[model samples]
Target: MSLSDDGGYGGDGHRGPETGQTRTRLPGGDGDLYGSGRRPRAGMSSRNLVTIVGVIVLLLAAIAFANRDGSGNSESGGDSPKDTGPGAARPTAPTGTKPVTGKNGQIASGFAKTEQGAQSAAANYAVALVSANILKPGERHAIVQQVFAPAKVDDMQSRLDAAYSTAFLKKLGLDAKGDAAPGMTYVSRTVPVGTKLVKLQGDTADLEVWCTGLFGTAGAKSTTPVTSDWFTMRLQLKWAGGDWKVDGFSQQDGPAPVNGDDKTSGADQIAKAVEQYGGFTYAR
Candidate 1:
């Protein structure tokens, strides 16, 4: 990731002129996604230059705006969970011993055909999906099998492995699996900022999880220090295999707020804290 906002996907599998991972597609512009697009013009008139600059500025603004939590309907605002209908009991949690429930009385159901339960199933599954544990091989595999749709399990697992490969880790100064380096703390945490039900019909709810996560290392000489980001993870949950399982999901960058001026911690302290603190079972 680059440090500035000029970044773009150069079509060479490398991040260009920007800092973030995902690149933006200009509105109404044709893309060679398969490698075809307009060739760059070397020079242009003042009017055209100004227009181009305006477009770039607008593009960035659009990206930022689209990503803003402007709706103000976020659960973090303390809105009460709504009931879908009368006499419907709250969704159940996975039973280690008892069932779990979500914001409303609705069952946290998944696809009846998938491996997990529904909404609650999807929420819980997402927790594990973005956890620090996935840095480990065995743990990552287990998480994939448990959270993903059975039909896509193998493909997802392989893709994830490739995405989190050694080169990727090195780029972040992390070890092969996502571990923080010695004397430094590597942070890759996904906090559930809120959960919203976009649509809920029998056995399926298109749930959107608003999340904020910190990714980077804490320490002197650290190039990629910890920084926070906001993204919405949309999950297509289905009831399958006796519980709610995720059939598909996708991530889009921020409706994020401006960066806050919080005090930074020492590298060692951050590392220790990560080791000491455990994650929570996020509820709305």
Candidate 2:
């Protein structure tokens, strides 16, 4: 009947020879039914692993490059002078009456957006706040009034006056006005360690001035010995009067370290030294 006569078994329309199932087999060397399956050869798997490793290596390299360039980090902007911490000496102001920037090209304006600017302002302001000027009643009032915000000025001034009253001066062997005894040397020097910007926004900067100061008398026979004190001064600063101005600032003692024993100088010598050496306008 044509080729259809032998369709009973394997003659024409039969199942597979081995499994006896009707299925489609691709033309290959007895592989899987769908296609040749060589179990994803070892070479191909290794190549894929190598590709992944290469991508990871590239990512690591890019990270290293970014770090080396100092672009992706916080302190690497090329615009300002190097930050040398708080021990760095700031430039002295011309009048010796105000604060100044520490390094050249450092912007100390309160209006500055850079970190250096904020730091510089805080350091200088701290120096001004803790100067010997605060011992004088009139000057102290002026400083508090000028430095603090309008709302807080009177309260701060009264509190400061009480804090530096005749009793306080007596404790330091000074008169009511906080002047050093005539024969004894009164040492009150505030040296900034470094400044940190806690927060900075347009027209305002919140800063902390980490400072170490020498207070009391430095003379060998002095009733009050010279001592070192550490304090942090917080400042809410504003750009006003053509420079960085302190809107509200307050000081509290310590975070100080243990005392170190050092030889003491004579009172006259200490007094003379205090008279000779002047203060600085600190910058960051």
Candidate 3:
């Protein structure tokens, strides 16, 4: 019953000396033992000095060239070069390939039995778990059934019901049924920023989804004005009945970025946008 945030969530370098001065012996024979009478040695020969300098210059040039940004010459033009190195950031844009084409009720289902499918399932389940739709008893039950394994649905439903109880709803200025007062819109939406596979094997995957969410009430007189929050959702999913389903999940505070000072929108404007806009079935 862990929901994403939105309130409901749950050394040193050595230096070399100069090459050059000629050593001269001191009159005292002690010079050989102590080497205290050494005189200035002749400076390095012009040819040797030039060669050494040339080698140094080449080394510097080579270093500069090696360190130059390789991104500028990318064949992709100005597009960021594809990073094939280990630990590279994932591409932000969709691959244009849908993660899953099947649906169980309104929930995306039948994800491929692959790592990508596991990620896709985790992301979509995260969205459903934190969505405003889950506020309603009917939709919550449907979400619980569709996103969790058959064995977990009943227990999950009871747990979620308690988590979203009348007291919790009241705190956010919502009725026992989880409805906002007239003229107010309750907001609870999760937008996954990215997903990472922590561990994947056989039929189980441990994933972490970084997300930003909007929650609270939107209305001129609303006490709980809609606001944004950042959080990470850790989902443990298992392949079941030919699809991936949430076996368990938990929420944690962010990996959040600093908030920007953007102009605030009016309640009506926020409500209008939410109504007009549609959410996506996220894919990895």
* Whole-model alpha-carbon lDDT for candidate 2: 0.47
RMSD of each: 14.4, 35.2, 26.6
Measured with C-alpha atoms, the lDDT of residue 78 in candidate 3 is 24
Question: How displaced is residue 181 in candidate 3, in Å?
Answer: 0.8
Residue 94 error, candidate 3, Å: 6.3
- Per-candidate TM vs. native? 0.59, 0.55, 0.68
Clashing pairs in 3: 21-40, 21-41, 21-42, 22-40, 22-41, 22-42, 23-41, 24-39
Poorest stretch of ten by lDDT in candidate 1: 8-17
> What's the lDDT for residue 110 in model 2?
34
Indicate the TM-score of model 2.
0.55
In candidate 3, what are the lDDT values of residues 42-96, reduced to their tens digit? 4434653443333223322322222232111111112232355211357757666
Query: Which scores greater on TM-score, model 1 or model 2?
Result: 1
| Residue 194 accuracy (lDDT) in model 1 | 61
Worst 10 residues of 3 by lDDT: 11-20
Pick the lDDT winner: 3
For residue 113, what is the lDDT in candidate 1? 31
Report the error of model 2 at residue 187, Å: 1.4
Per-residue lDDT value at 92 in model 1? 36
> Which prediction has the highest TM-score against the true structure?
3
Better of 1 and 3 by lDDT: 3
Across 153-182, the per-residue lDDT of candidate 2 in tens digits comes to: 665566546545665456446677767666
Better by lDDT, candidate 3 or 2: 3
